[model samples]
Structures are given as structure tokens and as C-alpha cells.
Target: MSKIADNIESTPHSDLAKGDEHSVKTGRILVAIATYNEIENLPILVERLVDTLPEADLLVIDDGSPDGTGQWCEEHAKMNVRMHCLHRKGKPGLGSAIIAAMQYAIDNNYDVMVNLDADLSHPPEKIPELLEAWRLADSDSTVAIGSRYIHGGGISGWPLKRHFMSRAINMYTRWLLWLPMADCSGSFRAYPVNLLRKIDFDSFLSYGYSFFEEVLYHLKEQGASFVEVPFQFVERQYGSSKINMRKAIVAVWTIFRLGLKAWNPF
Candidate 1:
């Protein structure tokens, strides 16, 4: 088991300090979002997130969006003291952007890191809830997943086919990989920064949208404890989804390969 996971499992839940409560010490949290061509949604997302979590810092990782998302973030950074931006030269995948942001959070010594979508698909209002889940569990919990498959959660804008596909994917993943949480594909999540640092970022191989799934699998193998919080997913209002048949095929292939590897150790 990973050192962090071992420590969490060993510690009693009742004794751990709850950071989410108003009485507990408010730790420095970095809310990181990976973006590409989200210029239209950037401002709205920033505004809502900032309003929701004024104490937490916001970091936007833009991968050379032709729509000038980086420039927009730069302008916003000047106005909002807690907002920062990282600009890349070309379109790197979502997974790469998140890795870069996570590395930055670790390097800066932030207490926690929250990853979400800039398209507003993941509700910005639930930031506190996810953070609370982590803090309440103390440092024992490695990840808090904002899940839509849970009882109080569901998707808003997805078509019937997409919804069916998502449900099937999650079900297959659960049966195949034995993932602990309900929504393994959900993007909204919170991580204890110190625990995340324990993951060897250099060894992480996934660079596509499937990175989230890969990270969860790795953490599970390391015995990381994951808590699921119900979240309502709202479809993006502004930009087109980057998902295509190619990405879907890649994700399925990756999941199968990883599942096999997990089941059979050479």
C-alpha cells in the first residue's frame, strides 16, 4: 500500500481533523482547470468559482487555445489576486494539462488540489462539498470524487445514447477493475496535495482524456481511499465537446489493457 493510504487506513476516522468544517483550519487549496478553446466559458467559470471559493486559489492551464484562452486568463489574473494561468504552445491533451497543474500545485506546497472542467460541466458550486469530504476525513482520504451516478446525482444535458454509454462504461469498469466509487469517469475531484506528491508524476503514462481513469487505477492499487460525493452534471453551454469516436475507442482499449494488467501480474 502507498504510505499515505496505509497511514489513512490505520488512523481512525473519528480522530482525524475535519478541514471542511468552518471550525477547522482552512487549508490552501489550488483549483486547477485544464482548458482548450474555452475562451467563452472561461470568464463565466472563473467568476462563479471565485465567488464560490474566495479563499482557494484558481489556476488555469491553457494548451495554446486558438481562441485566446491564455490571454483571457492573463487579463483576469491581474484583476483577481488568487487567479493564475499557465500557457502552453499547442494543444496538449487534458491529461497532460492536469499533470502540469498538479505538478505546479505540489511544487508550490499547496495543501490540497481540486481538478474540474472549465466548460462548467462540473458544477463550480460543489467545490466546498468536495473539499469538506477530504477535510472531514482528514488527510486519511486520498481522493474525493464528485460522482453523478450516486443517489442524489445525475446528468442534465447528455443525450440518451451518451448516457447509456456512460452508464455501461462505469458498470463495466466496476466489474472489471473493481473501482470503489460509483462514477469513475467523473472529472470533478479533490486531492490532498501532500498525498498526490507521493505519486511519481514522471512515471505516469496516460496523456489523453483517459488520464483520470489511469490515475484512479494507480491510486487504487496503492490503496488510496476514495470518497464519492453526489454531484449534478450540467452540460457545457458554450463550446463543442472534444470527445470523438477515436477518443472513445482509445479509452475502451486503454481500460481493457489496464484491467488485464491489473488482474494478472507478471
Candidate 2:
């Protein structure tokens, strides 16, 4: 178990000095979302999250987008103490951004953490259910994934090729890495700070889109349990996708490399 997880598991949510959990009726939570030119979506997403998880704080990890996303994050943080923003020097890969967010959560002593896209495809309303899952489980190692492949879960406003590719990615990772997850490529996830801290970011492998699956595989190896919550996944309304055909191809190659390395670690 991570030291942070150990601290939270032994300590009750009522004891946190930062924000009280009773308002949200959940633990001392931190919601993390990575951004790169998400100005159009970030504001509405942040507002909805504030209302949904009243007690939980939201962290925006901005990659210094040309858009004023980082500036908005700073200004918004002034008004709402619950909002925190981290501005990177440049646009790093998705994996690095997520790792940074997880690090911040661990450093700040939050009891639970949820990571979703800035695009609002992962509804903030489903947050309660994720926290509920953690509450029911006896271990702080429980991770809840907002899955689209699970029963009662699916996507909307996605092209057939995109949908098919998503399914194929899951199948590929599930078979190669032996992952039990149905939505290996999905970014909507909830994790305990302790469990996330246990991951070694120093030697972290993979980049770009493959980062999500790489994380799931490592977490499973560490004995962390998972819960899949079905939800409607929607396409982004604003901003073009950062992923390109070249990155997609590289992600596949990286996955195979990661799988082999894990299976036969030297």
C-alpha cells in the first residue's frame, strides 16, 4: 500500500482539515483533469463539478495551451479555493500530465482522486457512484473505472471507425497484457491517492494514448481492485483531438513493447 493510502485508510474522512466530506457525503476527494486548449469546455466542466462534488477540489493540469486555458484556471482558482491549477512549461504527453496530477494529489494528502477528460464526455454526475464504490470496499486500493464497454455503458456522437478502433484496442490490450478491463483506452477513472502513488513514475513507460492501458496493467499487478461503472461516453464538442494517426500507430507498437517487458522483466 502507498503511504498516502495507508494514511487515508486508517484516518476517517471526518478528520480532514482541508475540506469536509459530509457536504458531498463522500471522502476528502480530488478531481483531476488534464487540459490543452480546453477553454471552451473547462469553464462549464468546472462549474458542474463544483456543484456535483461540492466538497471535493478540482485540479486542472494545463500544458500551456495557446488558448487562455491556463489563464482561466489561475483566475478561477482565485474565486474558488477548491480549484487548483498546474501550468507546465510546454505541452507534455498525456501520460506525463496524468502522472503530475497524481503526484499533486498524493502530495496534498487527499483521501480519494478521480481523473476525467476536460472534454466533459465523462459526466461529473457519476462521481458519487465512484466514491460510493470506494466507501463500500474495505481497501483503499479500489479503483473505479467509468466504462463504456460494460453493460448499460456506451458511446454517442462517435464515428463507426472510431468506435470499432476503441473496441479493437481493448481486445488487443486485454489479450496481450492480460487485462480484464473492458475499456482499456478510456480515461474516465477514479483512484485512491495511495494506490496511484505506489506507481513508479520515474521509470514509467509508454506515451500519448497508450498511457491509460499501461497504468491499468501496472495497477492490476500491484493487487489493486477495480470496479467498472457504466456511463454514456460522448464526443468532445470543442477543440480538435490531440491524437493523430501517427500517435495511434506508435501507441500500438508501444503496447506490444510494454506487454513483453512486463511479461519477461529483466
Candidate 3:
């Protein structure tokens, strides 16, 4: 079972404007982070987010981290009015944690939901750039992406092998899934909550890191548009990476499967 420790009260969906149309420019925004043993990096991330985006609310979905990451979130939520924490049992998949945040955003009637990693690799200061791009987007279905492959954006502190692996995976996903964006695998993305509501969470096949790419595929199926915002992706300053060879293999296989299904949905 999951538990919530939140400072903000639940706002009714009826409070939203009628006709199901919502504008991100005027609607509430949520910044969500999915974490597992991210306590070492999370505090600094929280501080940066609070300082950088004072108007946006924050949500942390922790998967029962052994390092007391969930506990820290609970304690911090009490002091921060805009922060909320969802504590899930055991170490569930990364995708599930993000799905929970998506549900929370929907339930709370947020118009825009921005998701980022808790490891500080995705810069908190870049969030406003994504939001600004969202505000200026030509369509409401736009998913503003913080892309590292785009011009004016790059990666820092990664070895040649790691860089090659990342670029290869992105290339593979885009070619197979027909994803137009350059950085489809990165977690730094701003999603329109209204578009998220159109997707059926129970139908999703990805429960791991593949969720990042799979989500874009599904969003595109729902007529979602793309807007790439360049941002430098810095390697985490603290804590080891959660991804391993096993996870990467699974993600690749899953993307291949998704591609086949995309070509012929039986």
C-alpha cells in the first residue's frame, strides 16, 4: 500500500473551468520527482527548485528507499507548504512511481506536470525554460522536452562509453518508435496533465526506465506535440546511478517490442 504525506489540501475537479479545456499558462503547475535512495541528492534539489520555481508546487514519490529518503520527504513536506510526498511500499519500478505522480497531478487538477530526476543530473534551474516553452507552444498538446541532443545543449562528466550508449539508445528509440524529438529517453520533461488523463495507465507495458520513451509514444498516439528545449545534462554530483546493465537490456528489449506493436497493433 502507498501512503501520502502532503501539506496541500485536495482541490476538487469541479473547481476547474467547464468544458474540459485547460490552459497551462493560467493553470496550476506541479513539479514531480521519482526517487529511490536519493536522499543524498534530493535535499539540494529541493532547495534549488524552491528557489528557482517558487510558484510551482512539488511532489516526491519515493519507493521505500532504505536510506530514509521517504522519511526525509515526509519531514520536509511538513515544513514546506508547496511540497507533498507519496511513500510506496518496496522498490517498485521507476515508471510506476512516475505514474503515481501523474495521477496525483490529475487528481489535484494541475494543468501542467513537470517530471525530473532527483539525482540532480537534470538541472532544477532549467525547469522554468521548459515551462516558458510550454507557455509559448503553438498547441496545448505540447510536451516540452529538456533535450541534451539539441544544439546549445550538451552533457558533462560522462565517459565516452556512457555518452555513446546514451546516444545509441536515443537513436534506436527514435528510429523504432518514430519519435520526432532528439532526446526521447531523458526524464526532464513537462507534460500537459490534460493529455496525461487521456492515456490509460493500466494499459502501459513499461515498468522501468523504458517508461520515458514509452510515455512519449503513447502521448503521440494521443495527438501530443513536441517542443524541444535545450538544457545541459550534468552527471549527478552525489550517489551512484540506479541504472545497471540488466535495466538497460530490459529497456532496449521493451522498446523493440513496443516498436513491433506500434507497427501492427493486434
Candidate 4:
């Protein structure tokens, strides 16, 4: 049971995650997804996840989405013990939501944390690939990145502008921050609980898309080892993207700020 607030809701799913069922006794894994108005995607996503990785625990951090996402999660959680939801006051930044997720995972005594998009773009089926990578990582490994720029990774259904923007942002960050890895701008990542506990998340720089890049840089700089898993990036099937010109501009500028901070950590 979760040691969180009273509003925290849970129930036993028809399928159990423990005992003589699963072939692998993967320790407590929390798939933390942050959501705003992911009504259309959440249901199907949860169903597939429950069927796919029944052993994984799910935590949904909803930012007061008026679309009844909170209520929907509450209802589904009633039947699914693995499902957990955190209701925030309003639409907080994605970075803040992720911070909340990290705290939740640590507080609840989970071993591994995979934070990804609530939309199906991140692919729930590939979750085991991530966990497998994490499992195989060296003792020093703390983060595993779902990279789209690697040899076996690519993108599908993205507009030319989106592709160009993604490539450009990564290129910009690479030259400025000296990141050798591809796809630092992406959100699909896994972190070990003990490793994440060592970082100072309060000092995270970006609150939007750049948050992905900033944290990547910070973790690498802190001597954390990482593994890259190639996965195709896909466009969201439902709802509009939240990124706007303002967020993009902020992301660009944050890259330089990150670079400067790296140069002089004072």
C-alpha cells in the first residue's frame, strides 16, 4: 500500500503481479507518467500496460485536468492495485510533475523508476526493453535513455518541421553541452531509485521540454553512467501537443544556461 495522502486510491487488478505467475520477479518498478488532459490515451495505455508488464506499478500524476482524467484514474485504480495517481492543484510544469513522481517512487520504496509520456508515443510494450537494459546495466549505471537518434532508433508520423525542430534542438544541445548521446530532448528514461536519491532535483534547470536535456546533462556531469535503448519516436494519436513557440524559445536559451552552469558550478 502507498504511504501517500488519503486521496490516494488503489485496488487489486484481476491479474496479480506476484507469486507463481510472472516468469521474472522484477523488483518494485514504478512507471510514473505525468498527465494533464490525457483522457483518450490513458485508458488504452493502462489496459495494455496491465497486460504487458503486470509486475510494474503505475503512478499517474494529474494536474487538475478538467477533462476528468483524475476521476477516470481514480475509477480505474479501484480495480487495479498497481495503478496509483497523484492529483496536483493545477497544470504544473512537466518538470515539477516528474519531480513529484521521483519523490513518490522513493517514498513508496520502489526500486526502479521509468518516467515517460502518458500518451502512447513512448510505447508501453518497450517498457521491458528499458527494464532489461536497466537490469543489465553495470553497478555504476543509474540512468537508461530511450534514444531515437541511435542506430536502431528513428521517428515516424512526424511532420518535417517537428523532425527539424527535434534534430536542431539536439544538435544545439550537443555543441553547447558536449552531450555525445542522441535524443537528450526526449522524456522516456529510467533511473534506479538509489541513484536518483543522490541527486539534488531541487536544482533542476528547465520546467518544460528542456527539463529532459538539463537533467541528462546534470546526471552525466555527476558521473552517473547511462545506457541508450533505441526506440522509434511517434506522434501522439490523441490530443494536441503542449509545446508552443514560447516553450521552444525557452528550451533554446536554457541550453546555453546549462552550458554556462556546467562551466562554472558556483
Candidate 5:
């Protein structure tokens, strides 16, 4: 984490507090992306993010991708002012990547922090819409999820079995946890940085795909308010998905364990 801290200090922050705004605006977004061996998709993702939301800063936490993702980010940082990347030692799970990114955002006093994919599956253009929804909902809305299960929201390029499996998982989670949000598995979402700090990140148990489910369940238990925004879920254009059967098994076990924990916090 010292490397991350040092990187933050090295970046120029003179313009961060300019234009008569002591507190940041809703548009002052921090996009946090977790990556592992995503070198092919990263540059394109960064470009789209910069073009779609020029004011937002991007933090890329790479889990020591052997494919030179860290080096690529370093090279890009020289020319891109709004981009920062953190290189962890090994392939830490998605939850750890997000936690690290959230810590960075909270430490730097960002107004809103977003989690998105590097595979361009999550459209950068919809980012403003998520922020707007959160703003309209006011400070009480702790999270804004980019949902695929709601009306006008659906997945693309998935086989019948895959789609069915995803929906089944979400249904099981909702039944067991009673989470109000529709798409607990979806990772693309925005959160108020301050509210994020309220949740005990250290107590978060899951480190894989199930982390999304556990976090949402915990937030709901904590009385955190949230809203769902419909998003078109596109299939990845590059690189294979990291999800596997072992991860799926772990997700089921994690849900059972964490569900009980959420129900009985004592």
C-alpha cells in the first residue's frame, strides 16, 4: 500500500481544489477498476472513460498482472493526468482490488467512487447517469447499482445456460438475503465515498464474485439505501473471464456463511 500512497503523492493535485468548490461536486467521480492480465483491454477502457467523463479520475488496481499491465499503466501515467494505477504483489481477488481502490478514494477525499470493468462491458457513457441518480436520491442513497435484472436491463451475448445460471444465482441470493437491489452480482456501480467508509471493509469475507453479493447484503443489513439503474450488459470483447467452477462453488459456500453472519451479527 505504500507504493499506492507514493503514487498518489506523486500525482499533481494543484487543480483538485480549484474553481471555488471546497467540497467536490457529484461529477467529481472516481472510477476504480480492478484488473488482472487485462493489458489488451485497459488502454481502450481508459480512453473511453476519459472521453465519456472527462472530469472523473481513474484508479486501476492491477494484481501484478504478468502480462505487463503494470508497466503499461506506468507508461500511460506519464501522459495521462487523470489516470493512476496500483500494482499489487500477486493475483488477489476482485474484492481486495475493490477494497484497495475504495481505500485510495476515501483517503483522497473523493465525492463518489465507482467500480467498473476493464473489458469495456460496462459502458462509460452510463457513468454520468449513475451519478445523476445518486445525486437525485440525495445523500441517503448509499449505492447506485447498474442492474441487468430490472426492466429495460438485460444481458447480451450470453448463452441460454449462462443467462439462466446468472438469474438463478441472483434469485437465490435475493431469497436468502432479502436484498432490495436486483442485480447483486453486477459489479458496475457507484457509491458515496463517505458512506463506503462506514461499512467495515475489513469484516467483508468473500474475495471473489460472491463479494458483490455479500457487500450488498451487509449494506442492506446496515440500513444503507440504494437505487438500481438499468444497464445493457455486454459480453467481454477481449480476454477470457476469470470465473470458474471452483469460484462458483466458493460463491455458494460464501453465501451460506455470510448470509448467516448478516442475519446474526452478534
Candidate 6:
């Protein structure tokens, strides 16, 4: 057993089901989904994920969704032993939600925390592919990203303007931050808990979409390796997008500021 698991074995949550018992390949896994009024998509996403990776524990980090998303999570967690939820006040932003998830993984002694959008844009079935990639990663400090820009990967639904904006931000991240990953803005990623604990999440500057890129920059600073796993991305079929023009502007500005901290600020 891993050191994390050994620690868990001595805690109150020791009785919690161990993913390693079911799948020796993947250690204790925590699948984290950040939700903000995601009731329309969350239920189906949770079911699909539970079915896809029954071994891994599921955590829904909700930002006080008035649509009863947190209520649903509480109800479901009571019935599903492997399911859990974190309730936050108001809509703080995706960055804070993910940071909470990371802290939870570290506190609970999880080996890996696989984070994805709750909108169902990221396929639940591809989670295993991420875990496999992490397993095969050359370094222990590794993060596996489900990349739509990689070979054999493409988006199912997205406007031309959306595509342009995404590509521009990605190019900016690569050029400024020196990150080589093709999909820096994507949310589907698997982070090892050991590596996540090394960084201080409280000092994050971006609390919105830009957190995606900012995190990669910090991880690279901590000597974390990254691997891109190709996966098809589907646009959300339900509910309106939470992103706004303000958030996009903030992302650009935040990346520029972070870029200045880098040696090659171009």
C-alpha cells in the first residue's frame, strides 16, 4: 500500500472503500467536478462517471448553486458510499473550487485527483485513459491532460469565434509561460496529490478560467511533468455558458501578468 493509503487506514475515513482493492493499477483516485448551477448536467455526469470508474471516489465541489445542485449532491452522497460533496458560499469561480478539491485530495490522502468540467463537455469514459497516461508517465510529479488539440482529438461543437479565442490563449500560454502542452485551457486533467501539495493554493491570482493556465505554470515551476492524452471534446447541450466577456478579458490580462514573472516575457 502507498503511504497515503497507509495514513488513511489509520484515520476515521479508513472504512471508506479503497479503489486499489478493485483496480490495482489505479491507486486511490478522487474524481473532482466543480459545479455552479450544474443541476441539468451534473446528475447524468455523476451517473456516467460512477459507472465508468466505480473504483474511484467522486467529489462534487459546488459553489452554492441555487438550482439545488448542492442538495442533489448531498442526497446522492448519502446513498453512494464513494460519492462526496463540498459546498461553498456563492459563485466564487472555478479556480477556487478546484483549489478546494486539491486541498481535499491532500487531506484525504488520495493518490490522484482527476478534475473535469461538470458540464459533461469532457467525457467520463476518457478518465481511464488519463489514469493510464499518468501511470505510464516518466516522472512521479506528472499531470495528464485530456487534450482536444492533440492527434485523434477534436471538438464536436464550438463556434469559429470560440475556436479562435481558445487557440489564441493557448498560443499565448505556450509562448509566454513556455508550456508545451497543446491544450492549456482545457479542464480535464489528472494531478497527483503529492505534487499538488507542494504548491500553495492560497496564493492563486486567477480565480476564473485563467486558473487553468496559471496552475500549469506553477506546477512546471515545481518540476512537474505534463502529458497530453488525446480526447474528443463535446460542447454542453444544456444550460447557458457561465463564461462572459469579462472573464475572457481577465484571462488575457492574468496570463500577461504571469508571463512577466517568466524569464522570456514576450
**What TM-score fits each model?**
0.88, 0.90, 0.91, 0.89, 0.90, 0.91
Q: Which residue runs of candidate 2 sit more than 4 Å off their true CA positions?
A: 1-25
Question: Model 3: which residue pairs collide?
Answer: none
Looking at model 5, the pairs that clash are: none
lDDT of 5 by residue, 196-235 (tens): 7677776777877898888887677666788899999999
Model 1 spans with C-alpha error above 4 angstroms = 1-24
Question: What overall lDDT, based on C-alpha atoms, would model 3 receive against the true structure?
Answer: 0.85
Q: Residues 70-90, candidate 3, lDDT per residue (tens digit)?
A: 889878877776787777776
Global lDDT of each candidate: 0.78, 0.81, 0.85, 0.79, 0.79, 0.85
Better of 1 and 5 by lDDT: 5
Task: Write the residue-wise lDDT of candidate 1 on 1-266 in tens digits.
Answer: 22211111111122112222222356778899988899999899888997899777788887778898888887777776677777765565777777777776776667888999989898889989998898887446469999998899999988999999998888877776778889988789998777777777655556676778878887777768898999899999899999898998888777887788778968
Superposition error at 151 for model 4 (Å): 1.4
What is the per-residue lDDT of model 6 for residues 215-249, given as tens digits with 9 covering 90 to 100? 99999999999999999999999887899999999
Q: 89 in model 3: Cα distance from truth in Å?
A: 0.6
Candidate 2 lDDT tens digits, 70-137: 88988887778777777776665887778777876787678788999999899999988877877787
Decide which is better by TM-score, 2 or 3. Answer: 3
Task: For residues 1-266, write the lDDT of model 4, one tens digit per residue.
Answer: 12222333333343323322333336678888889889999898888888888778888988888898889998988877778778877565887778778877676667788988988898888889988888887764558889899999999999899899999989988888878787878889888887766667767777677888887787777777778899987889998788899988988888888889877779
Candidate 2 lDDT for residue 143: 86
Worst 10 residues of 5 by lDDT: 1-10
How far residue 66's Cα lies from its native spot in candidate 5, in Å, is 1.6
